[model samples]
Target: MVGVLERLERLRAAADLVAGRIPDALAGKVDDVLARSNRRLAVGPQTVVALAGATGSGKSSLFNALTGTRLAEQGPRRPTTATTLAASFTATNADLLDFLGVPRRHEVAPPEPDMTDLVLLDLPDHDSTATAHREEVDRLVRVVDQFVWVLDPQKYADAALHQRYLRPLAEHREVITVVLNQADRLTAVELSQCLAHIRRLLDDDGLTGVPLLATSAVTGEGVADLRRHLSRLAAGKRAASARLAADVTVLAAELDRHVGPARGSGADRRVVDDLTRRLAGAAGVPVVVDAVRDSVRHRGTLATGWPVVSWLAKLRPDPLQRLGLGRRPELESPGLRHSSLPARSAAAHSQLSSALRAVTAELGEDLPGPWRDAVAAGVREAEPTLGDRLDRAIVETELPAERSPAWWTLVRVIQWLLIAVVVVGLGWLTLNAVLGYFGLGVLPMFPLGPEDGLRVPVPTLLVAGGVVAGLLVSGLSRLVISAAAGAAARRARKRLEYAVAEVAEERVLAPARAEVARHDAARAALDRLR
Candidate 1:
């Protein structure tokens, strides 16, 4: 009983996961089964065994023989029973009878303890010409805890019976029985042949191992054996549990066809990586990385270049700041500041879409239709906000701008010293020229070297060497700045990619993985039912 309840709970959970996703027909059928099982379970522990058959099959006669009373109307008419009639040894199963919708009920005198637990039902002919009669049979067939298919010798192999009931209910063989009614009419040899033939037909209908009995409601032949079978089932008091369990198992199997097998593991890592890469591109990470490098070089050159010309570098705008990115903003801002980066080109957008589709396909390849659709829907739903999310990531990221290399400061100091030397040399030269021009006393000037035999004044050499050295230092500073900027760009790229990956996980991968998880859970529940 514990196993039975557990299986039913699993089936219910599995059904909930795919409630509106599967075919409407299957979903409706399962819901009906669940509803009926719940009502039956709540009713009581009485084992409601139904006697079902076609017209003139003596189903009602056998019902009377089993109960040892003529509760159900039995006659030679083509269709004697149009409504379901239930007979129990005790009158306490009114709720159970009400649930079964059998208004015509009768109570027999107290019987043996085994018989007291049984609620026997006599049902209408399954192949009746009247629709209501057939409907009643179908309804009672689903709700009953056990079935005794009564067959006369003439229609023992009825195609309608096998096609309509036995084959469709092959999963409930444990709770089903076949009784060859009116066996007294057949000689021993004929009975043996007929039983053998019926067994073969039942086997063909996948009803192997279902109990077969030869009963005569008129002569009471094989009636005691039928009673003993019902008595044992009633004594065990597991017929209701077994019947409901089988119903759940069959419904779960039907649902399994729509859910497919459990996924071996979580979403594929490669698919997630590919999705993140695509999202990064769409979010403009590459563009931001390039801007970071360019911004770094622009700032570095201004810091380290010769003071006389360093102001020229400042004239150009910082690439990152121009984009409204590269720096963190106030925490209270509603939305992150938009970047000046250009919108993605049509080709880039197309590539991003293709990548998203690839991820969807990879994740949903082996999933059932409903689950695959769920995954695709999740990806598409997340796509609309991807651009904004990427922008937010960029706004929140910290660029390498606040700190400068010590080398820039050292070079700036050296360049300033060289400018000072040039300034001093020019001042000395100007003084001498002015004094000589005014006919005042000429200042003594030192000649450090001679170029082509012409004496070169020390002051003139200082001015010329300082100007030339400053140019060389400026050129070297450009190279250093380029290298530093390249490193900064690589670091920025890593940070941006990490941010993009987080967004991908939150918006895209998370939803897709959730669908997969539901699929896995549903499949696991189906396994328990099996």
Candidate 2:
């Protein structure tokens, strides 16, 4: 058998797990059970059995007769027991009585050795016209371990008794006993008939297994049997545990209704991937990748292009720099930084919202309505920060830089040598022309075969060959840079996507998964209560 402390611990653990997720009303009920259980545990080894019944049921009279004291006043008034009155055979149950709020206490002689641990309470009428009287009954009923429902023959089958009290506590059948009090008013046959009808009514109320007995405070009929039953319960020392276990069982069933069937193992990787992709789009990851590629190509062209037009490349803005993306390693700051990436279009925003909804729906598919709502709320709570987090991620990421190719250096040197050749040739031709103009001797010049046997000018050939060679080198370098930049762009895109996926995991998926995990844990705990 599970001990009271173990059972109470389980109830407390389960309640803590679902503290904020469950409905307030249900949470309040669970809290009440915990509070009552704590008080019972503090009382220690005392059996709190309450005398509960409808108005004019002779419950107070039976209470007085059971304890052999007139602790509770029995009278002609409809609601005679206005407050709770307690009679304990044990003297050290003051804390328990205080916790129950029963101000009136009566000391009673121990009737039997087995009944020494009993603490009896005379509670107000269950169907009292005065709200305070009914409230007292409601409050004491929850705190008591066993209920000796002292019903009169007239009001034994009252709907208020069965429907309001007995039916709801059907799980506590083991701890409940129904008494046909005032039995002296009936003859032998009438009393039998009334007992039979009461049994049938209890059966309908789902209290069929609960014990039933006939007692009379006036005639003292069946009172000893009631006492013997209470003695057995008091001696067993199981009433507290039984009552708590029953309370846990009922609460577990109620909580179980809010949980759905278990989902098998493994995380939903596909949903996470899809959400990452959509968020990457919304976060302008592709734009950053494209910027990296363009910046790489531009830098390459400036390094290896024809020196004549390289100045024009320098005049244009660097693609990565325009987006605040590719700064020198030493210049970057260690703080959250935003990219100059443009705002997402209306369609992109819509796509992102749809993706979020889709993920929430898939994750919450089998969850109860409240849990599903919680999941959605969690996603919504994380959404506003997503864009900023992604931006920070993009800034933090080490993107591919516009690294210059090794051949650019060699090509640049060759181009400068060619330009030197052109300049030397031009100077030679100019000197020769100056000399010819003054009728001085002309300098020797390299000859080249030309059409119609006319020698081509050496100076002209040198300048033309140099310019063409430089142009050819620039064109070849452009092709190689373009290809390398395309590969770098692909790599950059993967890196940015990976960073965005991390943000999605932390900001969105983590909370949702935590909720699912809580649900699973709560379900498992409730199963243990069964």
Candidate 3:
């Protein structure tokens, strides 16, 4: 029961969320659906004995007879009720009737304490195809705890009654009561035969376990027996209203399963998840993280005469094209008789409206003004703008790190190496000049100075030194950068896991949790009402 209520709560919350955001008619529909839900929750769960039959069934007579009141008008003529008729037992039950939208009239019953708890509804002639009539009967049956299917002797086995009402509401068999009315109009022998025939037809209708009773409102025969049964039902100590509410809610939820998970999902969240991951990768977090680490390890290398390398490391990558982040995602493919999220969302919203249409149809009242306004507010609150929301979500996203250029360090290292080579070459050139001035030159590769033999130019030696430094720096930078990049990739991947997890919680998990909480609240409210 708790689980069932929880599900209903979720339905109510979802309805509330979409109610105002949808179009006018849609909002109106959702507003009523929620109202009915609350009414179902709050309606102190009485048993409804719906008086059903064709036009001449004298069903109303039975209702008046059972309560011992002239609540329903009777005639020697046809169609006493031009519209669907109803009279409930409680007056301060304004909230419940307001919930049900059956008009209020204080039709006094002749003081039967046994009848106080029972709300016997006098239904319209089922044969009448009046839109209003059919709708009222449907509304009554849905909320009613016990259905006392009133039938006349002649149309007791009517095909329309069985096909239209009986078969579909088979779930309410325990609460279904088949009353064979106008028994006094038949001879005793004929009454017995007709009762037997009705029983046989009931069996064929698969309503065998349902209680079938005989009565004549005019003769008052068997009325006490029926009243006696009703009295015992009311006298039961169980929470009848609570149980019925739970039952209706459970059935409604079962029907909701056909809608599937795609019904209430948000498109913004889906788009944002994919976008964040791609954007994070493109921002070059792996590269940036690696460089920060390497810079820390070789902190001295940059601080002490390696400003060039450090400066080059400061160049950030292009955020968009770095990891295919610039490309747009493929739109959901088109299909025959199938649709994408936008299309399905439209359909689902439409379906949501259609599902709730029965609520107003039953009650025969326009939605209360506040409720309609609230529904509009809710729809506006839940309005989906995947692009706008996605952009905002992206703007808020924090990448773990920003990567500098891969070649920047090499450029810096080469600059330092060039400086070292120039100094070395200058020393060598001065040594060669001094040695040649006194004929003691020993230039390692070319042993003689300019004066002693064939000499190397000082500028040429400097150039050679510069080439050596450049080559060494290039080779070393390649090795260092490789190691740095790999380490950065690993760290970035780990950090990215946390980022994704956080975003998922914010966008997906958080919304889902809220949905669950709303459902639980609704379920609790409904249970309290019950």
Candidate 4:
């Protein structure tokens, strides 16, 4: 036989199976019965007996005589009992028998010492030829660990008893006891004949192994055999507990049908996959790509030969409007403003945040642990304000209004200076030559020979050209500074996008998986109870 814990598990499994199929009324009753049985079983090995029969069968009288007390009513003028009754006295606390809902029997008796668990319930007689009394007996009989199926000499062969209770319980032959109670009323020859006839009826009822004893409450004839049997049962040295165990095993097999097979996988992977897909979309990588592209173009133009026109870079609808990515730079001059990469990137991050919030909220009903708290916090943190930072950076840098490649700027300055130099050089040489040819060379470096006669020196003019070239070189240097700043801003936007995705993953998405694991563990524990 299985051990107690294993037995309990089987019982629970059995209960779980028919738990649904059983009608509500029957189910509650079974639960009550099983719950009480578990408490009683906690007392260890014991036998329980419910002495049930027709009115005036001397069942209660015989029970009192066997237990050596008036444990149940005996002076019965049979009106067919109107109420159910029970009494328990044993070394073991057999009070658990009361959980069966049979009323306490009216009795004058002393409590017995705890020697062994034995309960003898004196139930309202069934076969009372009364419907209500019959129902009561049946109810008590269903839950007893074993039954002492008391019968009188007159009813021992009654067709109703044979066909109804005794016949069905015949299969449980070892657990049943049938007595021809009040048998002292018959003579020896008649007693033997009555006993033989009862055995034949029992055989007809399919219960050949059942033990039969003849007893009288008045004469105490053959009572010791019944007590000895009850004692052995109470000691759990009875074959009946093992027999009932077999029945319990059958019940366990029935219950097993309800418990599903065990396995390790405990999650719906599809849910997480769906979340990942949605979050990636919300990150808006495409928008960031567009912004970076524009920045790259502006940088390339500045590097090649775009002139001060570079400052004319325009971003529409305001960079600040890109989700949480804030305003365009505060470059006061339309001439110096460039890249909207940062704003576009920020928009992508916004999408990712909303997606995370949505998925988390979707799972909120079941969300467990830090994941629930983290997702809510992350969305709040995502709201950004870049307004004043860009404004301050732009204002502090005295960027020029016009923009162009340093090369273009330098080329422009050089061409102008060269023209001036060539013009003056040619003019001076021409004038000096003309004048000299007219014999004015004696006046020397008065190169213009006084067209307006300020007598400017050719060397001095050459020095001015050199100064202009130096200024052009300075202009180109500033262009490089502006182009580099734009490139850096472009890179910053990309970095920010990546940063947002990382934060959302760590704070929001990752925690959700943990929540699934935690709650699944909880579910697993509950499943074990069944």
Report per-prediction Cα RMSD to one decimal.
Answer: 2.9, 3.1, 12.9, 13.0
Candidate 4: lDDT of 39? 63
| Model 2 agreement with the true structure over 223-319: per-residue lDDT tens digits | 8999999999999988988888888888888888876555432357887788999999998988888898899888887878888888799989999
- Can you rank all candidates by TM-score, best first? 1, 2, 3, 4
- For model 3, residues 3-117, the per-residue Cα lDDT tens digits are 4355556556555543332356644543554556566656665545567777778888987888777778776446566554555555536565565566733545524566566
Candidate lDDT values, in order: 0.85, 0.85, 0.55, 0.56
Residue ranges of candidate 4 with Cα displaced over 4 Å:
1-48, 53-65, 68-79, 84-117, 126-145, 150-224, 237-256, 266-275, 278-307, 317-321, 325-530
Clashing pairs in 3: 9-519, 10-519, 20-375, 20-376, 20-379, 21-379, 21-380, 45-241, 288-403, 309-412
TM-score of 4: 0.43
lDDT of 4 at 366: 39
Model 1, runs deviating above 4 Å: 265-274, 328-334, 424-466
Return whichever of 3 and 4 wins on lDDT. 4
Clashes of each: 0, 0, 10, 12
Candidate 3 wrongly placed segments (more than 4 Å): 1-34, 37-48, 69-71, 83-112, 129-139, 142-146, 185-193, 196-208, 236-254, 259-530
Ranking by lDDT: 1, 2, 4, 3
Clashing pairs in 2: none
**Using TM-score as the measure, which candidate wins?**
1
lDDT of 1 by residue, 180-250 (tens): 99999999999999999999999999999899999999999999999999989988899999998888878
Pairs with steric clashes in candidate 1: none
Q: Which ten contiguous residues of candidate 4 have the minimum total lDDT?
A: 393-402
